[model samples]
Target: MEAALIAFATTAATLSVTVVLALLEFRRRRREAVQARREQIVGRVLDTLERATRAASRAPIVGWWAPNELEYALLLPRLLAELPEQDNAVATWVARRIQHLQAATSRREQVAIGADVAAKVVQWGR
Candidate 1:
């Protein structure tokens, strides 16, 4: 009877450890998945912004009024808000550029802001 009890206790302890390890692994994987999704969203926003910048260069005034520009302007704030505060320098830089772009009143100012944003996005890729 004592031997049986010892064996049962050993088995229970092993199972408990396994359960704990599995739970830890699950949590880790979930966090990684969330980070991956956030990165994907950030990439999309950057790509869109880059494309809009190119479009803006073609026609400084008309490009600012383009559909792509409007879409990017609408999406940037929400994406910037979603980014984690830590290790988010690129997001922060983009946010500042967006603010500058929004505050721009002249075509030359808009073009300059677009070029600056494009340069930062290129730098971030490295």
Candidate 2:
């Protein structure tokens, strides 16, 4: 009876340890997946911003429908939806970039030249 009890306890302890390790691994993988999704979302936002900037630069001031603004508007929802919690800075920066793009379009003015810098800084965290 003593030996049987000891064996049962050992098995239970080992099972508990295995369960703990599995849970830890699961948490770690979940974190990594979230991080990867965040990075991918940020990257796509950066690309859209860059493309809008380029479009604005190349677009003429006479047209009411700036292609860049249209494209950006189309992408805004997806980008906003994917933004992670506690990423207010990035969200704000993206908003500002969108505002600038729209303002430049509405005013029929030439696009700003610093879009790349803003996009890069946001993306690379530099």
Candidate 3:
């Protein structure tokens, strides 16, 4: 009886560990997929905005959109919600400041804005 109990306990322990590891791996893969989706969305946004700016004969990082306006900021939530993924909080946050991207007057400011937007890729799938 004692040997049987020990064998059963050992099997249970190994199965539990296997289950936990599998769960963790699934979580990690899901996270990576979400991040990839967000990066794709951001890329699309920047590309579209750049094209629009150029077509309008405006500079991408300067004077394409008005700067520091509370009114234009209101469009962010709508834009984010309209996306296929409604839970994209990082994209929502980015949309909040996106209009102002073209407001940067200097090259340094443009670079900073670019870097800040790029860094949001790691924030979350949501």
lDDT of 2 at 48: 70
* Top-lDDT candidate index: 1
User: In angstroms, how far off is 34's CA in candidate 2?
Assistant: 0.5
Write the residue-wise lDDT of candidate 1 on 1-126 in tens digits: 999999999999999999999999999999988767666765776677666666656765676457555766776777667666764776777777777776778756766787777666555544
Clashing pairs in 1: none
Q: Kindly list the per-residue Cα lDDT of model 3 for residues 53-107, writing each as its tens digit.
A: 3333445455436343333344355447645665666555676556556576754
Prediction 1 TM-score vs. true: 0.63
Clashing pairs in 3: 89-126
Q: Total clashing residue pairs per candidate?
A: 0, 0, 1
TM-score between candidate 2 and the true structure: 0.70
- Tell me how far candidate 1 lies from the true structure as C-alpha RMSD in angstroms: 4.3
Q: What TM-score, computed on C-alpha atoms, does each candidate reach?
A: 0.63, 0.70, 0.51
Best by TM-score: 2
By lDDT: ranked, best first: 1, 2, 3
| Candidate 1 lDDT for residue 100 | 78
The C-alpha RMSD of each candidate to the native structure, in angstroms, is 4.3, 3.9, 7.0
The list of candidate 1 runs beyond 4 A from truth reads 61-69, 80-94, 104-126
Candidate 2 global CA lDDT score? 0.65
